[model samples]
Target chain A: MNITGLETLVFGVEDLAACRQYLLDYGLHAAADDPNRLLALDGSGVELYPADDASLPSAPNGCQLRLAVMGVADEATLQAIAEELGKDREVHRVDGRLQSVDDAGFAIAFQVSRRQPLPLIGEISNAPGSPIQRVPNQLGVVAGREAIQPRALSHLVYFVPDLAKAERFYVERLGFRVTDRFDGVGPFIQPAGSLEHHTHFLIGAPAFMHGVEHFTFHFGGPTEVIQNGSRFVKAGYQAFWGPGRHIFGSNWFWYFNSPFGCHVEMDADMDLHDNTWRPRLAPLGADASQAFLLRRRDNWMPGPGTPENGDYAN
Target chain B: MPKSPTVPNCHAQPLCHLSELGEGSARGFLPDEDGQDRIFIVCHEGRLHAWRNACPHLAGAPMAWKRDAYLSPDGRQVMCHAHGARFEPDSGLCVHGPCLGQRLESVALHISTSGQVSLADPHLTCSV
Candidate 1:
């Protein structure tokens, strides 16, 4: 149960062409060309694969595959995992990655961490009350719109029927810490090696929901989230939510509906904390996450006679 | 009793009283459309903005449970409770989240001076 880190995301997509185009436009570097079997990578070597090929490992029609790579501090850590998990489940080695399934039926994989140091700008900010908020303005000239290069694959979410079993398997076995919880609802748990509020979130359901809920990658700033999101939209992908801040991870996010039956998110500036941060356990109430919620709006352009003639919509 | 097609549909039976939605709080209504329940309107910011409550992400409903749809602290952006997605209040633009640049089906409203609310295009079918 002691997971080292997130390795890669494997998706069972219906339309590989559309999914490939969506990921490419969303800024992922393509690694393969086959329509059925494609791979994409962000800066951190987090591989995004479309599981259209029948060769890939997949569950029955209503199941999902989650591959969480465990960081073995050394051979000892790997041995420890093998000793513990191998006692009950069958642990196989494929492509130098330890592959197994937890009690909850998610195809789990582990390996020596394959993450690289993502080149991301540090501490981006804007002039006070400036139009170019969240980005640095040099001499009244806004810096060129920067493309949001995903730093690292942050997390994955799933809808499961048994929240208790899923929580127990992840928390009791994998050494994940609960950063926050909606009592009787679900828990946001982070891997032992990561400082993100949570690396995996499980939501309760009566049956396994369609597939993966969503996946995200960390960006640098709010501007990156917006610019890259705008770029993805202009390229003709469906956006699902966000470009808003989450109270939990405190990251600015933009999520897009992918052809893979789940959402992909571009995130930036997540608040990182160590074990010292106390986990919050709140009852599943109306206002559990945010202080309040706003309904969707579409008025992006400033009204006529607004300051500086800054109507973004032409 | 058979449900009226033109009447706005909400999730919970008998649309939430206009007074129940505070100045900033919004409620999602799922109308029973031809035996299939559909999310119809969101009452927020003192305005009734209607959309096909399906989240563009996987076509899942945006709210997790009842009245759990997203709202920003400043009351500006309505976020999808499921995936942390956001939408602008006035334009229904998917400003943030998985549905970037996409928009919810905006149901035009006809507000009477006396404060009654109804669909602006009564003839339009709810086909989203």
Candidate 2:
């Protein structure tokens, strides 16, 4: 199977208006035809519907994620995926997409890739003694030069009751490779058609907690993660965890609570790898997971009464 | 920037009046240094109840996805948007999500006949 990364996710929400406003404020572009669908720079996006909407699939347990749509590389890959999944379960072809349920019972679909190319240049830094450098006099950051937008849909996470079964579904049936593993947690997986470290990550959990853990989009760099997160915080959205870097994929991340029944993340600067890279297993902890952690605080300058750390909380 | 997760200046502070909180609506109060609420009050089934802003699944995790928005979309269950765990608005018993079989810690409140509500144990708010 030549399944690509995330194409779009459909969310069945309670308050359509509030979720709409939340996505709009989260730096997502509005889809012209639908009031609820929001997109990133490339076309990967999320569509929202009312929880009672008949068109949306009921969540496997009772979580908010209704459908997760992955893009395939070609018509053959789409057909192949259909045949592979059709072996033991019902497969439906609705609106030219293959629809089936994974081993964990989450609704999934596949279609020919429609993601357009993003030609924008990402962030570059001028480091000492580095052969590659930015053009002369390009400042590191501009406070209000341009609006920050997510480049594309990055990855999704799920809380699975049976980690082995869930991992087998993607790794065996869907042609994904395990990039890394977290003991007592789950694995980070990459699809066959993409070089991204992992388009999906699974976390082992109880049956009642079975649902989407989080989904995130890629920004340009750590600057974008922090700056965009700061802007989001300024807009009154609640921040859950992050504005920090992870060790596995080396991606910078910032997570925020959402009405979508799970956390949403903004990430960037992920390490790309091929099958040549081997998977590693490590215990999940603050030290093993995060590279470092930082706290947000009011900007201040050193003064007579200034704390020794100068407003630094961590 | 939010201060430490501790509730600040809870002594003699009136959280909100009954008039400010309509029935079936939730409101949070006493933001710590970080502007994050320390406790939230909900009016459910014609009665008033208060709970710590933190969710049971994760320590110090605020229940709201945004400022003072702590209830589910239907205004029935008090929701922790961090992972969609919901609790009874009156009993604080989690009915769904990651913290299943858990309960949100309740905060005691003193509601006077005049409709003013204050922390019954102000010291509780100052810890976390």
Best by lDDT: 2
C-alpha positional error of residue A60 in candidate 1 after TM-score superposition, expressed in Å: 5.4
In candidate 1, residue A62 scores what lDDT?
36
True-structure lDDT of candidate 2 = 0.87
| Model 1 chain A lDDT-worst window of ten | A36-45
Model 1 error, position A57 (Å): 2.6
Question: Could you give candidate 2's per-residue lDDT for residues A187-256 as a string of tens digits?
Answer: 9999999999999999999888889889999998899889998888888788888888999999998989
lDDT of 1 by residue, B2-82 (tens): 324433322213344555556656554443311112444555556667666665754655432123334543456765545
Residue A40 in model 1: lDDT: 26
- Kindly report which residue stretches of model 1 are placed more than 4 angstroms away from their true locations once superposed: A32-54, A64-72, A126-146, A283-286, A291-314, B1-128
**Candidate 1 at A281: error in angstroms?**
2.0
